[model samples]
Target: MKKIFGIVVVSLFFLSSQVNAQHKIRIACIGNSITYGATLPNPEKDSYPGQLQNMLGDGYEVMNFGVSGKTVIRNGDNSYVSTKKYEEALQSNPDIVTIKLGTNDSRLPYRLKLDSNFIDDYKALIHSFQQLPSKPKVILLLPVSSFLKDSERQTDEVIVNQVIPKIRQVAYEEKLEMIDLHSITADKESLFPDKLHPSVLGETILAKRIYESVVSKKKMDFDIFSKIKEEKKNSSFYGYDCVDFIFKGRNCKVVKPRFSASGLPWVWRARFFGIEPQADIALLDRGFHLVYCDVAELFGNQEAIDCWNAFYEKMHGAGLSKKVCLEGFSRGGIYVYRWAVTNPKKVACIYADAPVLDLKSWPGGKGKSKGSQEVWEIFKKDFGLSSEEAAMDFKGNPIDLVPQIVKAGFPMLHVVGDADDVVPVDENTKIFEERVKALGGNIMVIHKQDVKHHPHSLKNPQPIVDFILHSVKF
Candidate 1:
């Protein structure tokens, strides 16, 4: 009886193992020659699918169903749907399907049919995968760049201008994730000796990119850091590399760390950048990217908010953290507070140094401090306030948004000098602190003894650093 019971237990253990093996996440890679690793030294081992399988470990089964010279359009010269590999892929019962079939379609014969048939055929193919018994999550991949000069064949011009746009349209219509392989590989022409197929190194890059997209819960399309070398003017910020670029005619700067922290966290400095370098430098040492966009004269108006909104979209698309730390100094405080109030959820935390909570308090000089009349006129124009009465009645200050700010639930930190005459602490930070505390909001204040607006930030910066790191949960 004991021998029989032991045999039953062993048999059950084997059955469980078999079930686990059968349940591995099956991935079907559908593409053309690029996906098949045509130019790689060893296609079987160095192909993107093989490398992806290794990266995914024992929990995933990645199968390469790529057939060379295949087009996504059904009426094209060589349609992927007509291939036996397509039939095999349909039978694989995959949980995930990655479709990357537009390289050969850029050829003249196939390119002609793309205008009418590309979107329809692509949707049909995606639908076929979606209807399978396993109901796989389908991901579309924009074809990699082809440096070949042959106009009649796969050319970078057609791929970028025509093919990639269609893929993006299809992905948008289908509501599926799309990875931008073309942009990722466009500058890596050296990896493609033949100008068409990626070598082993290129395949490795493709594999890693696909792996990142597959594993990430967020919808990451491309790595923005990859384009910094090609698109921006490089310089140095403190000790780190800084890249300057223009977006929508606005000057922008990004200071990158030697290594990025997890989730690619960043600090968005509103104005007066580099005024107080302590916290920025400390955060950089801890792997935080510092970024700035020039909305200086706009003064947190609708135009400034619109510019920030567009800039935020670009930054988020480039794979920065969804939430960002906002840093503001003096008049720059207006920009940060206005933007944060408008987009509360997008903020991780806020750090204001001798910040201007109320424009009326500083620029209007309606309170204890003597405000700037010249800047006040400009501020009024920017905000569309025609008279002093309009400026006085304006209820758009940060102090007015305490309830909304508190409800957004992001923490705040303020550094101020008791002797500040330019932007008095009593009329700004103190009032803001009282209102925020009354509303049960989280905020911290650091008072500088005998310090004025001449200098900003903390001497040690450890306290400010701790506040930021803790808020971002780094």
Candidate 2:
């Protein structure tokens, strides 16, 4: 009887351990009442985490470890660190962890007084997760917007002006993955009927967005410099790998660097290959990748933009930066500008060298300088425009689209030759600069005296590098 009892005890213990390891991935969601699915109908069944678990399918286990009105800051009214849920989360031994505990922290008196304490305490919370045995992949979430009448107690302004910046700082400082939940909820005011918490439909949106961000990223071991020697030997491109892949039935190329920066920042080079490529080489040396999508003859039509858009999405999924620094030389300016205008949010900044801003000015030869007759015909064909229509439609040019560019609001830098005949500066950069500034847009133009369109980039390439580094924070 004693032997039988001992065997049964051992069997039960083994079964318990086996059950714990059954799920391939375990997720622990740590947050305040918002994360607890506050105000949602049947929160346990329809909360963001619950919905996420359903989306992630049966291979994962998601546990919500949220406490009502808990602040990420330890000294707040009800600190999350002091909660039983925090202890429970620590014991959960999760593979992935999401921290979304700043909504209540946006409430006073913590709201007014958080300062650096929020960052320090948030870092500590992240450290706690990092030290866990599972070594979870930690993602921090910014708080959803607030809309209270007595805004001082729970103000969206304070959250945006104070809390959100600090959370971004933390993400940068820690090099961790971050989700801007505030932006997700900004326009969806109806989702928060009570002014703070999200409804069921809102929760569904939040879950889907988070799911996309997580799953879209490949999550492979990113080797900064993996196969340089082999690529160089095969493609004859020195110090870079010219990767050929098909996008929308068109053969495309992604010029990859052996080693790349932390956030995977890259410059999408537009038009021309060998004109003062010093800046690109310098950026590559500093761990930035350079890419080129061959749509040279297409100009900047809708089809070309669509093709580049596909490339952007693919590279972003392949772990390149979500935002790209667009570098356009000569006629390439139209490509970068048009693409940036169409997908404003995806651009870091624009760097143009002797750019052909106006199609009528460059290809049509209707301005102070003579244009390319062969290229002009191709442009007409691509745009489906007759000569009369092309001459009249300055509206499609970058110069005429200052309002849209200003609306997009990405920084612009142009290097121009004051004495150039081909792609004349006065007809392109001069007008663009004047109009952009008048419209309260950000543009910096560098003029080269007695220089023409022959020399493209700066000899040093330092200024261009500095501008891009500043814009992307690489």
Candidate 3:
């Protein structure tokens, strides 16, 4: 009798181990139409969650619990919590949850006073998942950008101004990892033909980014994981998180302050969105919000100007400071000056470093160094002008607008490399500085004696930060 009992016990233990080994990691993807595979050829097999499941392979089960036209805000038009799918999702016993619900909430008839309950409702939803026996890891997703205006139904303006900010605040407060869906999908206009939903290609990209974010944790070797763990802990102490949005089909990101600064000053960064973070991070700590619009390869033409105008209006409507201090690096010079020259009253000051003031110099490739033929082609295509037309059109270039910029009485600061051959100082900033000085404008140029355009900002960004703080007077 004892031997028989021992055999049964050992068999039961083996069966339990096998069952545990076969248990898959379950991911619950909860959201609205986009997650429902709206406008897709086949939502069931091609939705972002569907594609994500394939990427995650046989080890994971990704369930799509997306409800159509639902809002995360409980008081809004169609509250996600009120939906049957929300209950279904909770019952799935998921080990991970990804919430992507802000897009629908941004639509009209739903968003009326929706901002008030967004945080509390979002927290409640997260808490519901957290209270589960599995205690799933929750990841919040910022909604994708809207390419066209649908004021009667959906407007990206609200998403950019209201939804995204509240979502960021929730992520920061809850100490959860938030993904920048807006930034990744903002430039892929073709992927969203109807201007709202993602195509098959769009779903693929979304799935890939999500998969990368998930597997990045497991794939990290022991050494790298330890290093990252330490850095992440350190970052929590000194770092302020950034909320990214899509403004007029352009990617715009804002880093909020823990403590509000006086008058709410913001610095607008141009070109190379997240390359150098020392200055922007410092400014965030000092209670200044940092913003960026990805108008890459446009070279600041009329099209770029119009897009930026829309973004500025949205920000202003959202109660951002009236006058934005502009920070331009490399080719960003043109974007800075064009906007300022067109709307001088909207600009407080300008800080341009290794700026390409002339299209004919860098992108146009007409000057000292071997310029970018790729950029030159893009430049002409953007302006709808031939080489000769672009050359004749000095009206569009920043170099010709120096007198107007100077007359506007906005203080200017330029940090340039004297030895720079690409975007030669003689052709760009040197000439602008001389022209501005001749026109009796307030301009300051810091010459990095032996440096080239490669190293953009100062190692110690104190001077740059000081210039911005003084200019904004925050």
lDDT of each: 0.85, 0.79, 0.79
For every candidate structure, what is the RMSD over all alpha carbons to the true structure, in angstroms?
15.3, 15.4, 17.4
Q: Enumerate residue pairs that collide in model 2.
A: 225-258
Error of 1 at 2 (Å): 10
Per-residue CA lDDT of model 2 for 27-125, tens digit only, reads 899998888987877888688898998998867888999788899889755889998899999999999999987777787778865785888999999
lDDT of 3 by residue, 87-137 (tens): 999999999999998887777766775657778888999999999999999
Q: Which stretches of candidate 2 lie over 4 Å from their true place?
A: 1-20, 217-474
Residue pairs with clashing backbones, model 3: none
Write the residue-wise lDDT of candidate 1 on 4-31 in tens digits: 9999999999999999989899999999
Please report the TM-score between candidate 1 and the true structure.
0.54
Residue 161, candidate 2: C-alpha displacement in angstroms: 1.7
TM-score of each: 0.54, 0.52, 0.51
Q: Which ten residues in a row have the lowest lDDT in candidate 1?
A: 216-225
Candidate 3, run of 10 with poorest lDDT: 219-228
Q: What lDDT does model 1 reach?
A: 0.85
